[model samples]
Target: MLKPVELDLSELGELAQVIPGPEPKLELSLSPIPQFGAERPRIIPVCEPSLTGNELKYVTDCIESNWISSAGHYIQAFERAFAAACQVRYGISCCSGTIALHLALAVLGLQPGDEVIIPTFTMIATAYAVTYTGARPVLVDSERETWNMDLDQVEARITPRTRAIIPVHTYGHPVDMDRLNALAERHGLWVIEDAAEAHGALYKGRPTGSLGDAAAFSFYANKIITTGEGGMLVTDNEELARLAWTLRDHAFSSERHFWHKFIGYSYRMTNLQAAVGLAQVEQMANFVAARRANAAYYTELLKDIPGLVTPPQAEWATSVYWMYGILVQDEFGLTRDELRRRLAQRGIETRTFFIPMHLQPIYYEMFKGERYPVAEDFCRRGLYLPSASSLTRQEIERVVDTLRDVRR
Candidate 1:
C-alpha cells in the first residue's frame, strides 16, 4: 500500500494566496433531475467534432477496398495531406495524440536520467510522454499573457541534463515559439511542439506543427478534426520522419523478416481511422475558420461580464480557439466550480482547466514541494465553455445566458 506524499506548505508561497479556500461539497448530480412536468433542455457537450465532410465516403471506400488495417492508401494520403497543411514535409499517423508525442520523443532518442522542460499547465500527456522515455520532465509555470510556458523561467530551468523542451500551445493559443526556439537553440536542445489542441493555430504566420523540430496533433472526437480517435506527428526533418514511421510500426528491421533493430511501439493508426482523418483534414480550413469565428463571437459576448477573463491571443498569434476558456474572478460572485454546476443544471457542459503536473496525484510525490502560482490560479478559476466548431450562435447565447443567470 502507498501513502500520500507530505505537502510542504512553505514552498507554495504565492500559490497559497490563490487556493480559493476549501472546496464545498459538490452536488452529485451534474444536472438537476427534471421535474415531473418540466421539459429539460438538451445537453450541450463541452466539445464535439464537426464531421460534415467526406468522412463517410472515405470510410465506405476503405471498407469496400478491404483495407481497414494499418496498411492502406488512406494512411499515406492522410499523412501527406495533413503534413502539407502544416507546411511540413512529413506526417506520421499514430493511435492517439499521446502516442504521437511518445513517437517523437523516441525518435529524438531520449534516454533515462535526461531531462525535458515542459509547461506545468498543459495536458498530462505532455509530461507522460517524457516520462515514457524514462526522462525526467522539468516543469515551468505559464505566462499570463498567452497562457503558455513562460520563456523567462525556461532559461533558469535548463541544466546540463536538459535534452529537449516540449512547449504546448495551451487551448489553441500558440506559444511564443520564436523566443522558445531561440532559447532552445542557444542551449543546444531539441524542441517538440505539443500541438494536440492547436489544429491550425498560427505564430507569426507559421502553423503550430511547423514551428518546432517536430510537432504532434490529436484527432480525438473533441478536437477540431476527428477520426473517432487518432493523432499525427508532423515534421520537416526527413530522418526524424522516417525513424518515427518505422518506430510507430514496431521497428522491424528491413534486412530481416522478424529481426528488430530497436525497441519500438505498436502505435500504428488503422486505415479506417486514416480514411476518416483524411476526410477531416480535407475540411481543415473550414473547421479552423468556424472555430475562430465562434471564438470571436464568444469573446464579443463575454468580454463585458464582470470578473470574466476571456482567453488571450498575443499579437503574434492567431489562435484557433480550440476551446473558449475563461477565468472567473472573485467578482463573478460564484466559484468556478459553482458556475460550472449551474451551467450543468441548465444542460450546458463545461470543463475546468488542467490541474497542473504538480497537483496531479500520479506526480504528487515527485513534485511534492514544487509550486507554480500561475498554473494553480488557472486551475482554480478557469473553465471552458462549449466550443465545438459546430456550435451555433443560439447555443453560444444560451450558454452565455446561463452564465449570466448563475451570477444573478
Candidate 2:
C-alpha cells in the first residue's frame, strides 16, 4: 500500500513561523515550446535526490558515537526498519544491489552450469550477479506493454539444470510476483526478486519484495530512496536470512569471530550508510507520493501527444513511476535516438532503455541464433524523461511541450 504524505499544518506553528510567505511572482518566458524569436529555458536534469530529512543528523550521530563502521546500532535498526517496510522478516544490508543478488544466489547454492532465468531487458547487474555465483543466466524477452520479462518464456527457458528465476521489477512496476511464485513452486525453483526499482510499489496489495522468496533492493542514488550506495536482501525464511548475513561478510561462522568456513565476499554497508538509509526509509512514503505525483503530471501533459505510449500501469499493479519511461512510435517522426538528441539539445536530459542482453556482444556466442523481437523493439523505442521527484508542475508541462514539438 502506498502511504501518501499527509501534512498537519496546525501542529507546525513553529515551522510555519519561519517559512517565508508567498510573494509576487514574475512572468518569465519558460515554455518548453518557445514563442517565435524567444529562447527556450535552461536544462532539466533527469533525476535528483530529495534529501531534506534526517540524513545529516543520523550520519552525524554515527560519527559522534565513533561507530561508523558496519557494526553499529544504526545498522541493525536500519535492517529491522527496512525489513518491516518491505513486510519481510529479515533485511540483510549489503554493499550494492548487485552484491545483494550475489548473496541471494550464493545462499541458494547454485553451482557452476546451473541456469538462472532473467529478463534480457534489465540492467546488466542482474545477469552479472548470476554469473558471480558460477551460474548461467538464461535470457528472456520483455513484454511489449510493461517492458517486463514475458512469463511465457519461463517454461521454455527452464530445464533440469534450471534452479531459479530472477524477475526484476523494472521501472518501479512489479512483475506478477504471485504468478511468478506459483510458477516457481511448480518447478521447485527459487524466486529471487530483483526489486531494485520497485520500492514502495505494490502488486495485488502486497509489497514486491515480500512476495518473492527472497528479494534484492538497490539503494543507488537514483532509486526511489537512497543511502548514497547500498543494497539489501529481504526474506521470510530465517535460514536464508542467516546464510545471506554470513555470505555478505566473510562467510565466517557466527559462532566464532575470525573463524572462516565457506568462501564469501566483503559486502557490508557501513554504519554511516545505514544511518542515511534509515532516514530515507522514514521518508519513503512521502518520497513515493512525490514521484507518483510527478509521473501523473507528466502523463496528464503528454496524454494527447500522438504516437507516444506512456508508462504502463497494470490493473494489478500500483507503479511508483521510478523512471517515467515512454515508447516513441515511428509516427512521432523522430526515432528514439533522434528524439533523445533533440531533447538533449533542448536542455532536457533523457535515458534510453538498456540494450537487450541477448544483443550485447559479450553474449554473442552463448545466445547465438536466438531472437527476442519484443525486447529488441522496446529497447530501440523506449526512453525515460526527467523523472526527478522534485519536478514542478510547470517543469512537467515544459517537458511535455518539448516532446510534442518534435518532428522529422
Best by TM-score: 1
Candidate 2 residue pairs in clash (backbone atoms < 3 Å): none
Off by over 4 Å in 1: 1-40
Cα lDDT of model 2 by residue, 1-408, tens digit: 966544443433333222222221222234445442456575777888888999999999999999989989899999999999999999999989998999999999998989999998888899989988889999888887677899988878889999999998889998977777888999999999999988999998888789888999999999988898999999999999998998888998978999888888799999999999999999999988988999888888888777889988888888989899998888788777778776776778888777777655566557766777777777778889989778888778777777776563
Q: List candidate 2 segments past 4 Å from native.
A: 1-42
Query: How many clashes in candidate 2?
Result: 0
Instruction: State in Å the error of residue 33, model 2.
Output: 6.9
What TM-score does model 2 achieve against the real structure? 0.90
RMSD to truth, every model = 3.5, 12.9
RMSD of 2: 12.9
Superposed Cα RMSD, model 1: 3.5
Clashes of each: 0, 0
What shift in Å separates residue 393 of candidate 2 from its native position after superposition? 1.2
